[model samples]
Target: MLKSTTPTMVEAGTKTKKKHRTFSLNAKDKYYALLFLGPSLLILSVFVFYPMLRTLYISMFLTNTLGKTTVFNGLGNYTDLLGSPEYIASLGSTLVYVFAVTILTVGIGLLLANLASKRLPGIGVFRTLYSVTMGVSVSVAAIFWLFIFNPSTGFFALLSNMVGLPVINWLTDPTMAMWAVIITTVWMNLGFTFLILLGAISSVPTTLYEAASIEGASERRQFFKITVPMISPTLFFVSTITLIEGFKSFGLIDLITKGGPTNSTNMLVYRIYKDAFYSGNYAQASSEAIILTVIIAFFTFLQFKFLEKRVNY
Candidate 1:
């Protein structure tokens, strides 16, 4: 049976609707959101957007030694940089450095993480020793290695003498200079990667391993099939950061090799610094900087795209 609503009931329903509408945002909530977001937007504009825009703008112009823009060259700077031998060499060196560091650092970190994940006695000491390098600053770490690489009164030298092996001049030789830079960079970055992988390993469920064991799977097989797949996401994260750090590494190269012994250790970043500050070619530097950014962005995008398919979660 249909029932007719009374005036009191209709009035009450209308009042409830009106109350809901009153509580909902009209304009004040929008204002408050904008207010809260204002500082972050402002900071991003000033630090990120502005610098990027300015660099792009500066890349198109020739600048004086006195830091004054002279003439607009359009794409001429980039075109010239693409053909320059020094730029090409620097790009090659950077690629090699980045590749080596990314692979070696992540590989070693994963190994250390796996070792640390084991529930054996004194594992904590091993973990601590592995991650202790994280506390060392880049410059400080480079200096520490520098002392060890020294030919006279150095640990490596002393060991070589004791073993009757010829001492190697790590920083002086061209081929050895790049090796020194790579070693220093990998050592400096290893701790962070180890810590990240260790956390990832710890978060994984132990039941999976037990299940695999019950199936008569060996430790090696379980590691490859279970542990590695389970931790693929963390591996992707580690690879991404390691690649970024490899590209950004300048202090170690600067301190240990100085792009030296025939520019063996000069990566794109150090090249950028040398072009801008030393050679007084701000325009060229800006162009190279933009190119480097594009390369890094391209590889980073590729990494995400390729690695995304492999990540478990």
Candidate 2:
């Protein structure tokens, strides 16, 4: 009886010791994780978190040219903006611009990706040319388009002359100015989107296409049935990114249209810029900035909630 009891006690003590060791290891790992994450957290706190909070605070007050708050108006800036026709028009234009750019960019990108994915001679050269715009800076691209849009001596002018068409004002006319910027933006964004979609299309298993061919599947049928489904996840990601980028677009608008011939191309970002810097209305800009952030966040949430369900992987 004594031998049996003593062995049982020793086994229980060993189990307790093992548990203690495991707990210590887990605690040490947690400390190391926190140590590694500390710097990133600090940077985000300083740059992202603090500014977000500051913007929220500033949006509730009227600020001077230097951005110093002088009067607390708690939502007044928001109400005024909502009631203003100019602001409303700007918001509507921004929405139209974002949707147009996103749709055209993604559509054209997918088409180019599909074309480039074909196994043909000199395909590499075509691929290089398709993605070359990604290497160009936004300013440079804007300048290039500026020359192309020139009414008198640009490429469009020469094309018009060849076709016996009148040289249209690409940038000066209000209606045409918006389309001009949209076309430039689409061209600029095409390279990145094309590359992403091309990579996605390339990763799809060739076995599926071979199997489809065995079943007498046409190219269009195989593409819709296999390629699109296989790359749906990547497509979703690219669309989301493009949509957000379209919303945040400012530099191109600034360099090209300067908000436009009559504010027809004045997007939300440009409006915020004009309000803050040019108009010296920091409070209004802060409010507009916050609204834009909320709009982006809301759309992102909707995409994740609804659109993500369709992703294959």
Candidate 3:
């Protein structure tokens, strides 16, 4: 090495230093991050996780509301619910609605997604108009729908006259009420499901569709063979979401049906809500809530087992 001939510096006298950064938490940044996370963590623990744990605990007990003592019932509640006629009917109704809504929502959503994915004229405006319902609160939508499906002085009456259709009193008739609620629920939610599916469909490479078309695949064939496969993952996601929402359905039951017309639409969530708030059976309601959660969890696990495995990507 050669030494520099500068007046005050030789080669050994000068060196360059590189600055380095570490992941050590500084007071300001650490505090800010903690502040950002504080509310969420608090909410998760207090409102969500705590209540869930408490429900689980209560599910194991019997309580005397009059005497003010919660004794260990030890699976009695589950047995009673399993055997009781009303509880069984509620469970059945809930399941029927779940299946009905899940099928309609996914099918309609897929169709819309496919249509919108083609970028047809005026599709964006159509998408906005259709999807606005998703932003409308479920309860609010159901209340509005209840009025629409009401027998007298509502849209149903006007439509029946205009189309010469039968006057259907959906909310009052036991046979028609659940169907009306199901249709309303599906219509309100279809937009969100469509948007999700459209994202997945658009993400698929155009070259694939072009190749399929060149190979003489019809639109139906292309849909089933290419589009479905490409969006299998999104389908799985959408189906899962639909299934969860169907299981937890309460707003429609409360606002539209009120579990009414001889308990034709007694969804588990609404039953739990009514039991706790309306009937003042906190212990039983807690038990019911716990049972519903377990059923949902079990069904979800089953879905992941049989359905989730089919996801392409």
TM-score of each: 0.89, 0.90, 0.83
Can you write out model 2's per-residue Cα lDDT over 83-125, one digit (the tens) per residue?
Answer: 9999999999999999999999999999999999999999999
lDDT-better candidate, 2 vs 3: 2
> Local error of candidate 3 at 219, Å?
0.7
lDDT to native, each model: 0.88, 0.92, 0.82
Top lDDT hit: 2
Candidate 1 per-residue lDDT, tens place, 239-280, comes to 998998799888888888878888888889998898899999
**lDDT preference between candidates 1 and 2, better one:** 2
lDDT of 1: 0.88
Model 1's C-alpha root-mean-square deviation from the true structure amounts to 9.3
lDDT of 3 by residue, 200-299 (tens): 9999899988999999999999999888988997898888889999988877777787888888887899888888778777778887888888899998
Checking candidate 1 for backbone clashes, the offending pairs are none
**Cα RMSD for candidate 3?**
11.1
Model 3 steric clash pairs = 62-73
TM-score of 2: 0.90
Q: What C-alpha lDDT does candidate 3 achieve relative to the native structure?
A: 0.82
Query: What is the TM-score of candidate 3?
Result: 0.83
